[model samples]
Each structure stands twice: as structure tokens, then as C-alpha cells.
Target chain A: MSTVLTQRMIELQGLTKRYGDTLAVDDLTFDITPGCVTGFLGPNGAGKTTTMRMILGLDAPTRGTALVDGKSYRDHRFPLHEIGALLDAKALHGGRRAFDHLLCLAQSNGIGRRRVTTVLEQVGLADVARKRAGTFSLGMGQRLGIAGALLGDPAVLMFDEPVNGLDPEGIVWIRTLLRQLASEGRTVFVSSHLMTEMAMTADRLIVVGRGKLIADATVDEFTSQGEHWIAVQSSNPAALAAILTDAGATVQKVDDSQQVRGLKPIEIGDLALGAGIAIYGLTEQRATLEEVFFGLTGDSVEYHGMLGSQNGQAA
Target chain B: MSIADTAHTTPARTERLAVTNHAVPTQSALRAALVSEWTKLRSVRSTVWALILTSAFTIGLGTLFCWAYLNRRERRGDSIRSLLFDPTARSLNGVVLAQLAVGVLGVLVMSSEYTTGMIRTSLAAVPNRTVFLAAKTIVLGMVSLVVGMVSVFVAFFVGQAVLDRDGLGTSLSATGVLRAVLGAGLYLTLIALFGLALGTIVRRTPGAIAALFGIVLILPLIAQAFPEPWDVRIGRLAPFNAGQAMFSVRYDPDLLTPTQGIFVFLAWIVASYLVAMVMLSRRDA
Candidate 1:
């Protein structure tokens, strides 16, 4: 939507939540800025949803605060107008029609019925608006949830696992919707455990592991944090390995090829040329976002397979 | 349509919606909350079905009882009016069953959200727990009041019609008759409110229903097991027994006055509601 950008920023300051002895979120502090989609990334049980809940004031933090546009989310006079969140797609009265469900939330904020209809139409649920939410498939339910969040036309939107059960079309639809909302200059904060999902949809990402902030950077920067290595296939593997190691590069040798870190492909090519060894093939490999995610969150995973490596290696 | 087309059309639609700002008046939080809660209560099947059941039982059973009583008395060639036979109480006998339906409705009003995990959505909308709860109480209480009054009055009229066939019916102008009928309605509404409060405290449908039944039905039965003055004292103090005193046609020296009984029930409702609100604010959704 073409509109004036409302500068709303959500800031979490040392937010911590503990249930008895178990810490759900620990010392989380970050700012979600407007005009872009900021992905909240974490493995399951790493407190992404808990942090979102605290932001929406659904859960009280044990220590610290979640502020929206400088004040607590609950402190806003028109909270729905300031921030709209879909904490759970299925969190609705199943017996009520989808239209009535959004209407209920809309009326709470004194929003008009016309806005409800518009939102239902926007979510492509206008045809089945009268159907009970209980009968809706997961994708339809997710759309209904989005309809509720947009009921007030809030400047800030938060969605938790918006693509969880969506079909591919639904997934693409929400991705475009999130980007559209951000383009309208509204802050869009989406939470997901899938790194590739965030990589495709979010410009900036705030990643967490075991309730602690791991990285807060743009997608470009995040993916770049993954180890970049040059793979070299040489006529003389032994000479190339020595040359790379002597040049302060960590080298790992596999069959017929050497993985060299801390050296550019051009440097390796030059070193091979000086060593008088023919470079049969040379390639620079960058770690994928998925690999980066596994590397960052590997240690904090609540469950692990017996076959998985403990040193952050991809299984 | 292409993704580009969907994207192209969305902004125009958003702008159209954004143009008409409903201009919601800056009223008290409770006013907005009340509107929200009224929408929540009415848009569900449970409320409609429960009220229907309450009406059916209260009127149907009362009519049956009145007819049965008139038939039996006529066969014996005896007068229906007697010192021991409180016709008002007999005509309103259906309330004992009807109250359960009202109680279930009240409990479901709060507990259904818990079961469906909608409390998170609700609390996020209205973060002030006190205002949110007060609005719920007012909406449910108002609905229950209307339903209770309509159902009980219908039962009374139907029951009296049955008794009228035998020329032994009492009119609303008769001594204590109007009070008993109105009191029955008030009693039903109060009991439902009590259930709503218990539901909030328990946060589960079955648990709330069990606790409500314990207070409204089981406790009175347990009180009857005592002897002499203890039985009378405990029974008079129990929730259902004390509330029932409001609708009794005959005066009992052992029980509370109608006003006192209402106040006692009110105390129970207020206390439970406050505790529920306190616990609601204290706990995470």
C-alpha cells in the first residue's frame, strides 16, 4: 500500500521469562525497525514465540521490558491501531464465522465493519467469510489470523510462524504480503524456525539461540558469516596443500581436492602458478544460510539425533 | 491473477478502507471492553444452545409438574391449596435443572477461550485485566439476567395456566407470588454469574462445572446430613439453599430473609469474581 511511513519501532530490553527454574527467554534485547521485515529466528524452544508473547504483553516478563514506539505495548491507548499481532493462527473461537472472528477484534478497537470486510477480502476469505473457523484448513486459518491482525490497519504487525501449515501458494502469498506491509513503511516482524524461509522473506534478521541473541544483521551479512572456502583441484595436491598452509590458510584435504580457508581463490591460483603446479579446477564455496543457521543454533538445539555431529557439522 | 496484480490492487483497497476512519470516540476502556465482550458472547453456539436448554427445561418441566400435581389431587378429590403444598415452589421446580444449563453457559463463556487458546488473542487486545474481566462480567450478567427473567416468567405463566385448569391458580398479585417469581429469575442470573466467576478461577470447563455443581447442588445436599440446628444453620448458609430462600413462598424461621439471602449470594459472586480477576492478572495467558 502506498502510504506515509509511520515510524514505529519495537524494542525489547533485557527481556527475560522464567517458569519456575526453566528460563524460557533470557536477557533478550533488540530493536525491530520499520520499513522492513525483521525475522525473529531461533530453533524450537529457543524462545522466539515467548519473546513475541512478551512483546504483545500476553506473557509478563520476569525481568526487563518490551516497548513499542517507546512505551509498553499494553500502555497504548489504541493498542490494536498501534500494533497487530497474530500469535497463533488457531487462537480463535472455532464456532464463530471467520468474518465474525475478525469483526470481534475489529469492534474491540472500534474499527468499522467495512474494514472487516475489506480485510476478509484482502486475505482472500471473502467467499467463505460466513464459514466457521473450525472448519477452515490450516492455510485458511492462517489467512483468517492475518485478517484479524490487519483489522485495525495497525502500523506494526507481528506474526508467529505464519507459514507453518501453509501450502506453497499460501507461503508465497504471505511472503508477498509481509513485503507489501513493509513497503508501506510498517514494521513487520515475523518469527520462524526455518532459516531458508527467513532468508527469502526478511531483509534483516535477529537470531536467537537458547533465549540469547546470536546475531542481529542484514541477510547479506548473516549469510556472509558462514565460512567461505576455496576448493582447489591440483595436479600436485601435496604441493598445493603445503603452499596454502605456509600462507597461513587452514587446509583440509579430501579426495583429489583441497578445502582451503582464509585464502581467496585468486590467491590460491596465484600461489599454484608460482609453485609451477597446474590448477585443474578452482571454486569458491560459501556456506548456505541453512548451514549458517545450523552452525549458529547447533549447540542450543533442545533435541538432537544420535547420528548428528556435535561440532556444528551438517548431518 | 499474477502476484503483481494482487499487489497492485491491495493498496487501492487499503486506501479506500483507510479513508473512512470510524472516528471511535475516546470512551472509557470498560466501554470498549464491554462492546468487545458482547460480540464474543453472542457469536458462539454455546450461548444460544445453553439459553435454549435453560428455557426448555424451566418451562417444560414446570408445566409437567403443575399438570401432574393437579391431576393427582383431582383424582383424590382434594383441594390443591394447602399449608404444606407451596404451589409457587412446585411450579418453579424446573429451576433446579435449569440452573445447571445456565451454569454451564456461564462456565463456557470463559473456559471456551482457554480451551481454544484464544485467551492470548483476547488479553493482547485488552491488556488491562480488570477492565477486560469487568466487561465480561457485565455482558454475561446482562445476558443471563434477560434469559433468566424470560425463562422463569414463562415457566411461571405456563405453570399457573395448568393450575388454572383446576381453578386453583395463584395470580402475580397474590401474597408473595410476584416476589417469588422475580426472585427465581434473579436467583438464576446470580447462579450463572457465580459459574462465570468459577470458570475464570478454574480456567477449565469441566473443572469449573464440577466446582459450580459442588456449590450449587452438592453442598446443599451435604448440609442436609447435619442434625437439628446445625443442619438448618449450614443449609441456610449454603449457596443454593440460601439463594433458594429468595424464591420460597412459605416463611422459614431458620433461613435468611429474601433480601439477606440475595446479599449472601451476591457476596459469594463478588468474592469469587474478585479472586478470579486477581488470579487472571497475576498469571500469564
Candidate 2:
């Protein structure tokens, strides 16, 4: 496993896809290394699926290359052995039984039927192996997709929006499965628009916006980069706001509280104490992962809701 | 990177195989794809049902037609043998209906993948586009050929047996009789390939079927409306009429010879396949 992991890596360099006048994926580059789950974060139409398709050689890149372990995916003699990807779990014939569906895929890659049975057992679909895939619940369908990815037992695995419609139990199952794959030294790259899913499952993140790279960093780094603010509640709000503005801290009044930036909670406390003003409360407001995601993708969101239109008031 | 040390319940045997340095000796790319396609073709209920209907119509309708003809002969007080009526062709009259069944089967084999988005998974596993397409063709062609031949043979024998009771049937040992049966099967196979090519080109079930039926069935009828030498000239070139020339026992001035008819059928198949290949190779899945 270690030997396989050391040699397997996915690299994309200046990869671009254009459909007539629209640029789908524009000049994006990233490397997915083994032994970790790298979350690919992007909004809808951000080229996440396009990039994944290019990596699998399903769609050609108009400009650059997507390489797996130093070679194009098309060049690999045993593609499934090198990389097993579940681009869309629903990409299967509904009329086929689950076992037969996986069997054909396994046979295409020269994998044994025995492995098909094993994967069925592993995904907990053993009892329903003879059932038609069309009848499966969304969670069962996802499990079947993961079974296909593991059929070849490839060194690299990719799942696009794997937990899209899964129940809480199914989502937890996928999280544990992804972590286990990473711990086994497989390069596990998963793509999703949901930030919370990535926060719980991903060790590193490559965030994209408007088909371009926005942030590629560790989860800790990504979360910490969002600006933090210090919130202070004071009896004399206008005087405290003036003092905070004078002290080089940006202040915004919200209801009865004043939000201060560029200053720590202790610093704001000290300022209020020195100015002979009583502070009701001082709290540090750290940005949540969702906020960090929105901040990075604010301008790139193709479909965004109005900030305060829900209540017909501006924020 | 320590899969061996993991405490998860994944099968230990597969882990060993996964960690191995070399792949097991497997079939070549094309052969494996063929095997995969064969597995896929047989596993689907649609394929089985389509082939069953093809057989049922070919044999069932053939018997019905022969029985109806026998009743008409009795009423007319005609002799058992008629020089004008070709017993061989009448025994295989079911080919007309079976053609649609075989054509639909061919279309579904390729079009279902497109509709269900299974083509992406298929192409990802077998990246060589030409090889993948060829494998699909091989599997569909072989299955259609075998089923078509069996269905036509059953139709011929059963229809002949019904006619034989009145001493009006042609035997398999007869020279033109065997050729007609074999030709009917060949025609069915060619029609299936034609349907498959159109399905690959159109990438939709209804559109491809409509195109296939339009060219093979409707165009022939439309061509008959033309004036002067144009009708016979265009009619002979129609794929369906040209292929029917294969089963004819007597020569007609308006119809093509067996050899010429086969060439025209082959031409249509090759043309459709070339167009399909170009489209499949160039397009994104």
C-alpha cells in the first residue's frame, strides 16, 4: 500500500475547457497527493465536474493536461487499476441488477467477479445484490457507487458530490470510508459544494470560483484566513464606537452592540476600561467555514440570494 | 500509508491483491471489452425481451401466414403447386415484422447507455474509443446474428411443415429454399447493424428508430410514386428492397440480382457505420 501511494499522484497543469464562447474551466492547476482526502470545493457551474471529467479523460481539455501518476489517464493500460472514480453515482443503467452492473465494470478492467461480491458485501448491499439499481434509495445508490470505485482497488479514488442525497447515516458512512481509504495511503479526492461536509472529511482543500482557483490550502489555513472580528456591547454605544474608531479598530454598530475589527477582545476591553466606559460584554467572533466559503466565492456565485431580501430589509 | 495495519473490516484477501505490484494476466483490451459488452447485453431484461419478441413474431406470424394461404388455396380449388407463387418466400413472410424487433434491439443496446449516462462509465473503463465501439458492434452483431438465424430457421421449418400437410411446401434440401432462409437471416443481421449505427449517430432511441424505419420502410413506398424510369431506378437502390432481393427464387427485371443486392446492403451498412464512427470518436461523452 505504501509503495502504491508513493507512486500514485494526480496533477493538473493549466487545464482549461471551453464550450464555444463559454469558458468552463480556465487555467486551473492543482495536485492531489496520496494519504489524504483533498476536498474540491466550488459552487455550481464552477467547473468542478468538468475538471473531474477531464482528469478521467471523459472530456478533453481545450488547453492543458490532467495527469495521473506522471501520465495521462488515457495512456494507462489499466485505467481502473490506476484510478477508480465515481463521477456520478447515478450514471448507470437502471434496468440492470446491482451485482451485474458492477460485474461488467469489473470485467472491463480485468478485475474478478469475486471482487464484485466482496465489494457488495463491503458496501452492505450484499442482500440486495440482485435488486435493480433503479429501485435503490439514494443512499444505497451512493454505496453502490463507492462499491464500483473500490472494485478495482485502485491507488487513487475520486467521488464527485458523493454525499449529495445521502441520509445522515449514509453521510457518516462515507466519511469513515473516505478516511479509511486515505489512511490506507490512497489518494482520495472528493468534490462537493457543501462546506460542512468538507470541513468534517477533508484534510486539505482546493477551492475554486468562476472556473478559476481561489484557495488551495489546508483546512486550518483556509478557515483561519477569514477575517475575525471582536464584538463589544456597551451601555454608551456611540462613545465606545468613537473610541474604537479612534484606536485604529474598524467599528460597525449592530442593534445594541458594536462590532470591532483589527483588535482583539482583550484590546477592546482595555480600550473600554481606559476610557472610563462600562462594557456589558466582549466576545471574539471567529468565522465559520460557511462564512469563509461565502467570502471567497461571493463574487463568483452565478446564482446568489439578495442579502436581506428575505425580510425586505437591507443589512 | 499503512493499509496492512488498518483495523477496518475490509476483506484482507483483496487488500493483498491490491497491494500486489503487478496486474493479473487478463484479456486484451478489445477482448475484455467484448466480454464486458456480452455480459451487459445478456444481463439486461430489454435485450432478452427484444430477442424473444423477434423470435416469436418471426415464427408465429410465419405460421399464421402459411395457414392463411393454405385456407385460401383450398377455397380456390387450386392445385397444391403453383408456378407463380414462391413457396420459399411465403414461408418466411414474417421477416417484415421481425425486422422491427431486431432493429429495436440493436438501437436499445447502444442508445440505452446514452440515455442512462452509462456511456461515461463505459468509456472511462475502456478509453480507446474505436476499440469500445468495435466491441459493442461485435457483441450486438453476434447476438443478433445467432438469434436472427435461429428465428428465421424456425420460421422456415414451421411454415414449411404447415404447408407440407397440403403438399405445397418447399424442402430445405431444395436449392433456392436454403438460400432464401439463409438470406433472410443475413438480412436481419444487416438491419440490426444498420439500426445500431443510426442509434450511435443519433444518440436517442426514438429518433434513431424513426430514422431507421424511415429509410428502410417509408422511403421505398415514397420512391414508388416517381414517374418514368425513376421509380425502378430508385426502388432497386432502397436498402429494404435490395435486401429482399436476396430471398427471391425467380429473377424480376425490376429487382437487383442476389450479388448486386448484397453489395447495396453492405454499402448502406458501411456508410451508416462510418458516419457513426466519426461522430462517436469526435464527440465528448
Candidate 3:
């Protein structure tokens, strides 16, 4: 309960990183405000993890600064007592027992033994704590890593792809834990390739593509923008377009067929029925962050067309 | 900056221990880092075997070398006292390789963090870079000390046993014997520190190990192959060959003596460690 809290928890101001000729993080600037689960969302190579590394002071920024609580991570005397992170869950000594690994980390931060056990219990790993980490399943490792992150009860926390190998139950557990940590006035910034997971867990989303910030807004706001569109289908496509146009809605042709981009699905459906357009198929379409992503990402041709996506996961 | 901190300063010296006030400025952070690293060391079973193997190899080689070299050098000398052995020098012959083992282990203890991306977690937990590196140096240095002592002592006993067979001995009371033993331990410690520096610089286990071999093994070998003046010139600069003088019992006026060689070894260790700190500060882990 005595979690030492710091206000500006984590901040990145115009952070940039380059590996030889390639820039991995490009002039990225964002702040992880306290008391919320700010979801760091991106496609492969979007620099979420790179930003995390810079924040932790593991990577020296090429251009700008990454600060934790208004100071650099290097300035903190007892950093673990203030912040915790699971940058990579598998970044562990696989041969050591879960208990020993957590205990050692705890000892480094001057956290007591009782708190180790408590964190283990909280992460539902108390029984498996004695088991060597190598034998644990990936989900178990993620849990153990999360347990380690909580060992210090720091006011700020970060996790990079924490659910990569986790099961549904483990994912739920982490989502709840992250939300709970934030509720206790801790800053929680988590990065994930799983957009759907972030949609569910993160109150706010910071979207990036091609190592640049695409959007930083509430989840609700992102989802709201895409809700006005309707997918219309009919044999008399031109007739339908004409009617929709007459209704003061914008329409475009997609794939030499028909593209409709205005009004609710129900309104379109009613209009189509009344106009005897003989609809083949009709569905409501929301311009989700996913769709906005598609629209914005398709334009990111510099990397896609020039170099081709090269990480294990393709663009 | 606070009045509170000033007021809490220690008063005039007293017999009673003032653990809180008199502790080193960065000791707690250093201690925390040591604890973290020690945990990491024990978590891997390979560390135990590495220590055991180093000691066994050093002792076995020292004994073998002592048996062969002693029998040949003192075979016909009949002063009786002339055969008195230097247990210290004979015992430390294995350190040449044993130090490599401790050095490799020290390198892995750190560089592996970078190779595997665990450095992110480690640095995030303990963000003060200088304090973190200082703690690593202290803890790893201490481990190397203890391991080096055990290996050197074991080599001494085994070598002593072999010399006993020939009734040829090296005097443990000799002027340089104690210094050699201490030097052997100090040498191993320096090697470990050098390994740590290499680890920080290369941030790759294989690269660091290769660099170590190049510095400690190749430089000396390449130096010897050169013509006289070049050999002497390069030999003076290469670290281990110069540092090895510390463990020798006999003084050679033609070469730098054991005592003088120590300063070079220290210079190498200090320079490398400082370079490591610089690279560590600037590089992306």
C-alpha cells in the first residue's frame, strides 16, 4: 500500500532511434499519463518496444529525451521502488525457479520476502513458484513476469506484448490486473500487436504506423468516427448510388462495384427497399480504428514499397 | 541540499559502529545490484560447474607442470636446499586458463543480458547506469577473488604433492611466495573485470570472448613472433604477458619484474573498465 508514486511516470519527447541506416523509432513523442491504461498500439516494427526501451534508459535516444517522472530513469536512486516493466516476459533466467527469480528482483529493490509471496499469489503463481521457469508454459512465464513487475508495487508500470503467449484466462487476468493497477492511481502503459485486445483493455489508444504517431485519443473517439458508414449492395448499383446521392450521402466506387460512405445502415436499408433497388447484400460498417488504420496504412508506401516489411511478422 | 540531511551527519568519531551514516555513498545501490546479479549467478547451474572446472583444471595443470619442470630443473642440484620449491609459482600455472573461464563467465553474466533483450528489464529496474555497473564490478570481482583463491590454493597443494614425490620443494617461506599467491588471485580478478569490460563494449558473448582471446592470447603470441625490438615493444603493451610477471618466483633483469608488471595489469584493467563505462553509457542496450 505504500507504493511510491510519481506524477509524470513516463514521457517521451521527440524520441528517435536508428540502427545503422534504418530508423526504428522516428521522432516519436508521447506521454504515458498517470492513472490510466494507455494502450500503445501499432503494426509490426511500429516502435512501441523501442520507445519502451528508451524510456527504461536501455537505449540512448538518437535525438530527444525519455523521462520517467520528470527526470531521466538514471536520476532515480531507487528506480524499482518507483516503476516496473515487463518489456519481454521471456527475458528471464529459464533455469531458475520462479520463486528465486522474483525473490532476487525483489531483493534488488529492497522489497521484502512477504511481498514476493504476495505478488506470486496475486498473479496466481504461488503454487508454481517453486518450479523452474524453463518448465513453465509461456502463459505461466508471462504470469511470472507480471508477478515480478508487481514485486515493487511501483506507481508506474509498462508491458510490451504481455499477452503474446498467454491464454484467454491469463489475458483476462492481466487485463484486470492492469486496470486495477491504474485504478490505484498508477500509470499503466502496455503495448500490444493485438489491436482487439487493446480495444477492450485500453481506455486510450496511441496508434502508430511506420514509426510515427497516427493517432492519440480515447478508444471511444476512435471507434466513433467509423460508425457512420454503411455497406450497400444491389444489382442496380448505379440506381442505388443515384438514390443515395439524392439523399445527400457521398458514394464512391470500390472495386468497380459500388462504395457508399454516408448515413446509417438502417437508413440505407430502408431507402434501398423503398426505391426497389433489389439489394443483394447490405451491412452496417463502422469506421473502426482498424479501418482508419487501413486507410492510413495503405498510404505508408515509403517502407512498404521501398524496403518491404522485414521482421518475423510481415507488414 | 536539505537541512535535514545536514543535521543527520555523523558527529565526532566513536567506537560504536555508525553503519547508517558512514556507509559508502552509493553502497546501497551497489548492494542491490550485487544481490540481483548474485541471484542471476546462482539461478544458472552452469556457474557452479564453471567454478569447479576452473579449479580442477588449474590444479591439475599446475601439479603436472610442477612435476615435470621441477624434476628437470633441480634434478642434479645437490645442495639439498637447492631443491626447495616455490609452491606459489608451481601452483598458479593453471590460472592462465582458469582466469579465462572466470572471465568468460563474467562476460556472460552481463552481455547475455543484451543479447537476449533482458537488459531492458534489468536497466528499467535499476536505472542508474554508473551505480549498476559499479555493483556488477564489485560483486563479480568478489566472486572471482574467492574462486581464484580456491583454484590457486588447490594448485599449490597438488603441486606440493608432486614435488614431494621428487623430494624437491619450493619454499613457501620464500619472499615472493605470498606475493605470488596474492598476485594469482589479483590476476584472476583483473581478468574478470576485463571480461566485464569486453562484455559491455561488445555486448555479445562470442564477440567479447573473441576480443578477450585476441587481447590476452593473440597479442602476446603475435608479439613473440616479431623480431627482437618489435617483440619487446609489443610485449610491454600486451596486458596478460606483462601481468603474468606477478606470479613468477625468479626475477629476470632482462624483463620487467613481477612487482613492476602489476602496475601494467592494473592499468589495463582500469582502462578497459573505463572504456566499458563509456560505451555502456552511450550504446543502446
For each candidate, the alpha-carbon lDDT, in order, equals 0.84, 0.85, 0.75
The predictions' CA RMSDs to the true structure, in order, are: 4.0, 5.0, 9.6
Once fitted onto the true fold, the runs of candidate 2 whose alpha carbons sit more than 4 angstroms away are: A1-4, A233-247, A255-257, A264-282, A305-315, B1-25, B73-81
| TM-score, ranked from best to worst | 1, 2, 3
Give me candidate 2's TM-score against the actual structure: 0.90
Candidate 2 lDDT over A1-315, as tens digits, reads 234325588999999999998788999988999889999998887889999999988898999999997999888756888788998888899899999999998888888899899988788788788989988777777778888888877888999999897766677778888888887778899999999999999999999987999999999998899878878888788888898889898999887788889887887888888989999988888799999999999898755675555553211
Q: Which residue ranges in model 1 land beyond 4 Å of their true spot?
A: A1-4, A305-315, B1-13, B16-25, B72-81
TM-score of each model, in listed order: 0.92, 0.90, 0.84
**Model 1 over residues A214-270: C-alpha lDDT tens digits?**
889999998788888888899999988898899999999877788899888889989
Clashing pairs in 1: none
lDDT, model 3, position B189: 78
Model with the higher TM-score, candidate 1 or 2: 1
Clashes of 3: 7
lDDT of 3 at A264: 70
Worst 10 residues of 3 chain B by lDDT: B15-24
- Candidate 2 scores a C-alpha RMSD against the true structure in Å of 5.0
The regions of model 3 sitting more than 4 angstroms off are A1-8, A230-285, A301-315, B1-27, B69-74, B77-87, B164-167
Query: Better model by lDDT, 2 or 3?
Result: 2
Against the native chain B, each candidate's TM-score is 0.88, 0.89, 0.83
